[model samples]
Target chain A: MISLLQQEIESQPEVIARLLERETHHIQQIVAQLPPFDYALIAARGSSDHAATYAKYAWTTLAGYPVALAAPSLLTMYQARIRMAGALVIGISQSGQSPDIIAVLEEGKRQGRPTLAITNDGSSPLAAVADHVIELHAGPEKSVAATKTYTAQLAVMALFAAALSNDPRHMEETQQLPTALEATLRLSTPIMQAVERYRYMDRCITIGRGYNYATSFELALKLKELTYLMATAYSSADFRHGPIATIENGLPVFLVMPLGATFADMLTLAQDLRER
Target chain B: MISLLQQEIESQPEVIARLLERETHHIQQIVAQLPPFDYALIAARGSSDHAATYAKYAWTTLAGYPVALAAPSLLTMYQARIRMAGALVIGISQSGQSPDIIAVLEEGKRQGRPTLAITNDGSSPLAAVADHVIELHAGPEKSVAATKTYTAQLAVMALFAAALSNDPRHMEETQQLPTALEATLRLSTPIMQAVERYRYMDRCITIGRGYNYATSFELALKLKELTYLMATAYSSADFRHGPIATIENGLPVFLVMPLGATFADMLTLAQDLRER
Candidate 1:
């Protein structure tokens, strides 16, 4: 099943490219429509929501937009304390038919709020309600679990940032996304191999910081979802506060050392984990 | 610092109550508007994000609103490919001054969407841009670590749900929230005392399902945050897939059991964990 899903993902490269293009266009259109306000609200659920965290860092530093991420429950279920008179609500999902996502959009419309949706299914209820719709175009993800859609969402989001900021340099950088994804797919082999080493280990700690913090989270989620591994994600700083005490010689600690300003700190934290 | 923070939190019951009342009234007024929309978007950070997730369940089942949660990163950095129009964007925060949150709201506004801010600080940038404001009366949360504010946010959200649905049943149930919180606080005493028993244990797992699943995640977060304990949270069924292999005699496993549908299933799982 994993292999089949991987194939489905690989076959969707064109879909990814198209999704990125459409997302870029939508963002540019939204940017063209109104005056800049305070910040952007990136709303999603499950794996797509985790990808939004990654988007937060990319948009803030790369696109120079202040952003905040939230779950829909806050608006629909929570007392309508939080209000947006002229803010974009970007809803994301693979199926785009979840009742929660639809309800959120309905409430927004009644309030005369502008809403958007990114989805794999163009005909999904979410798409029907959205003022603008960016199709993921990843095709049918047969697995109950999501993999390609996740990466596609991330890619599309990155492209959207490039479009909104009108940064040609960033846009060019996004062109490399497919290649990077391919490279990442290759890298997963070694990671899977490494997993065999820890298959017998009692517990696993996955650690990263800053933007990579979400990567660590997604990695842990994937490990749990795919391999059913018992793993926890933590920020490098938080790991030292107490989780490290459990390091009894040879416990598995998978560290994601993504290149960024925080790389040195993360490396140091990884070293500390090893020493412990 | 931790003790001081704890003291401040304990002493703020009156403040929390007052803030709760104020915020509840504000939410009622907002939901009464029930503006036409397709979906709701909630943007929040940190503990407030957790409260948002808790609200998602209530929104879907109780108020019958389709909602989606988002991270600010998607809107600010990645410009996530989401359809944004006719949707309400909600920004939630205690301080409401996080640069990312501001950026996301600004982006949403530029898209001509309705924006809302739910905050402890009405003067914060988040509130400054919001079309509607639900000010959390949480008073001053002195702790860098949030406790009472999180609980208060949950309470406010619950009350908001009740107000929106015009269903006082949940509201009446929630009136017991303060007492339940007090009981939970009291229950923690024994859990804290018992922490010593498992502090030395090499591994710990926390499991729950449905709403309690979020509780399990929060519990793991607390354990990691407060004690630096390496803990993993999982849905009860998800645990069986692969994490169960790690279960053995002497490994510590914590179950956050709610008195509902999952009780029997969790009991069986607990027995399996014990046997393993």
Candidate 2:
């Protein structure tokens, strides 16, 4: 019998495939309806914040829109006034239950900024406040670890970037992502076996940057949440600076080696870590 | 013998005082000579990235200028074009040796944006490329863990915010921080006594947000750097969503409960952690 988490982790390919194919019109509409703003401000918490960070990289490099991750406590805790005019405010949450995120959306809407939400539940509070909502279309994820919904959120945001840029290549790659995910899932058996040695592994670090830096964060969170591993994440470049001092002999390190312009540098980091 | 790190931590007051008193002219010159931009883009790594996060909170709430933390690899790794015009780019570094940060400053300069660097080494690479440089007056910190420099960087950024907004209240607070830090350092005797139970502590989380979120990050980093503690940092609001699930009895939770708008929430979070 597989855990609910394992089941959901395996379901990502199907969920992402569905998200790209069925729910893109909503994102397209969001892209069309949003105000022409100089930048974007995103509000989220937990895994959703990691997803939002991914969008920060994508929106800058792909769409030429500078994206800033909002520290919602500025609104909720400090009670500061935010200038939302000529900016798009996006709230990313799976349940849409995070009050801080909802506050940002509501505030953005009140300030006449175009507000958008990417949430699993369109009926959730975030949706109620947002001017446009792009449902994650990831159905009822039951795992305490967000295996399916995390990937689905990534796909949805990737598609969102694609829509905003009118870039067909991104759309084509996103459409093919489900297949890539499926092929990748084939290693689960070996990965399960590999974890047997690390049952007592107490310390680790995850390194990534560029487009997949958010993946490093989410993966680190999942590892900590589900396995109780004392894992930390750093950008590959950052790892070189000083945190590398924390690495000891036999310390486990995880690298998200996504192929792209960052691949060569990540490979260097991987080699450096191996040398340690 | 007390390590250099401990000495540096104790020297924070003097370093910050020197910074505010002596570096005011350079900052004022920067304020007077810079092109007016819509917002700020900050680039940093490791502990400096944590400092950049503090600037994000301050620039948004205090100065009414939204700041985006630059993902440097977007240009260095992905070879992507960045929109830098009409923005102020700041690179924060202790040594000013991070190539990734230098890349951001160089690109911002090429794009004709005003670049300012805050660093301990006025002669380091970051200074050569910047349109303006504010030296951290924290002299000769030899420890692997930064102490005086981090606090100095924080003070400098606070002063920058004060100057940007021309807020006399913030300026007053900035001026008083050194004395406040000196007074706070007086508690080291009790603090050292308090850590007896946690001398063997292996796991912890540092919670803070708003003005002190960067303090949370810095504290967590220092714990990892010096003590090998598996310390993590989170905004109090984000902690409640999931990572709180990781808390067990006897886990060390350090809260940076500054007396500001975030005090009530930090108190609530401290209570919740105690209950757990």
Candidate 3:
């Protein structure tokens, strides 16, 4: 019998495909109804917050809307009346049950700003307070770790970003994500073999920047959740800040450097780390 | 001979006092001259970024302006023209030398938005590009890890928040920081005695939330830089999200629960960690 976690992990391509197929037109319709928001304020936690971090780059780069992740404590604990004038508030959660996240969208609605919720459960309390909801359609993430919902949330963000940009090309590009994810899943044998080498590793650092900065964090979270490793994440540039001093012999460092704008810098840092 | 790091550490009360005495009126004047910004977009790295994190809570709570930390790579690497229509772009750097951070402010200026620089060097390129500058005034910082300048950056943010709030009470509270810091320094003996036990500890996690969430990261960075320990920071609420799974019987966790709105939550998390 396959473990629930492994089943969900392997089903991501299908999960994302179903989400894109179902949510693309729905997201555009929702985006069309929203007031002209100058920027976005997102509230989330765990893997969902990591999704927000990805949106911080993707939305700002692709949709021309600056994105800020909300300090949910400000709403729930401090009772801060945050000025939301031209902002759209969004809440992302797998269970959609966190009170702090709900408080943010509630506060946004109280201030007469548009509020959106992206979650696996459309009928969840988080969706209750939201003016619009994007259901993940990933179906019951049974494992403690959120795999399918995380990818589904990212797909929803991509769909919204595409809709916000009013560019058909963006949507067309997103249509290719399922195939890309399917091809990437084919490397699981090599990935599992690579994981075998790091079995004894108790600690590691994951690094990336720009869009994939969120990937560094998500990868670290998965390691901590599944393997109980003392894993941490940092942007490649931020690693140069101070934590780089902690690097020593036998320390495992994972660099998520896909061939993109940040590749050269990450490659150089990899060399620097090798020298150290 | 006293190490420069210790010298700087011991001088924080005086450094903070000097900053308050010299920069209070200056920050007010700069604030007065600035155009009304709906939100703040801050660019920083390392310890300075932690200060910006402090502002993300402080400014939003006190000044009622939502603050977002910039993804400097978006401007520098992706060449994304971020929407900054009503944003007050502020760059915080001890040296004011990082090009990625400088690129954020430069892009803000290119977009005809107001830009500010908070740095120890008034004539640095960062200051040259900004419409306004707040110098840290900590004299020469000789330590590799920033000590006085970090606190100085926080002071500047407090001053700005107070000014933006147009609240004399906030200014009055800011004036008490030096005395409070002085009192905190008196606990150095006990702190050192406590730290003695952790001498052999190689890794740890620090937790806090709201304003002190910044403190957690800053403390973790100090531990990593000075002791070469694998230290990581998380908000107490965020800890429950997933990272709590990584905690084992002997893992050391530092809880920065200053008495305030977040104290109760942090205390509960500390108890939870104890059980784990």
Which candidate leads the pack in TM-score? 3
Better of 2 and 3 by lDDT: 3
> Candidate 1: TM-score?
0.64
The count of backbone overlaps in candidate 2 is 0
TM-score of chain A of each: 0.88, 0.96, 0.97
Please report how far candidate 3 places residue A150 from its true position, in Å. 0.2
DockQ comparison, 1 vs 2, better candidate: 2
Q: What DockQ would candidate 3 receive versus the native complex? A: 0.79
The true-versus-predicted C-alpha distance at residue B276 of model 2, in Å, is: 3.4
Candidate 3 lDDT at B45 equals 81
Expressed as tens digits, the lDDT of each residue in B98-196 for candidate 1 is: 777776577668887788787888889899998888776777776556776776777777776677666888767766665666666677678778877
Which residue pairs show backbone clashes in model 3?
Answer: none
- Give all candidates' CA lDDT scores: 0.68, 0.82, 0.90
Q: lDDT: which candidate is best?
A: 3
Candidate that would win on DockQ: 3
| Candidate 1 lDDT score at position A158 | 78
Per-prediction DockQ: 0.13, 0.54, 0.79
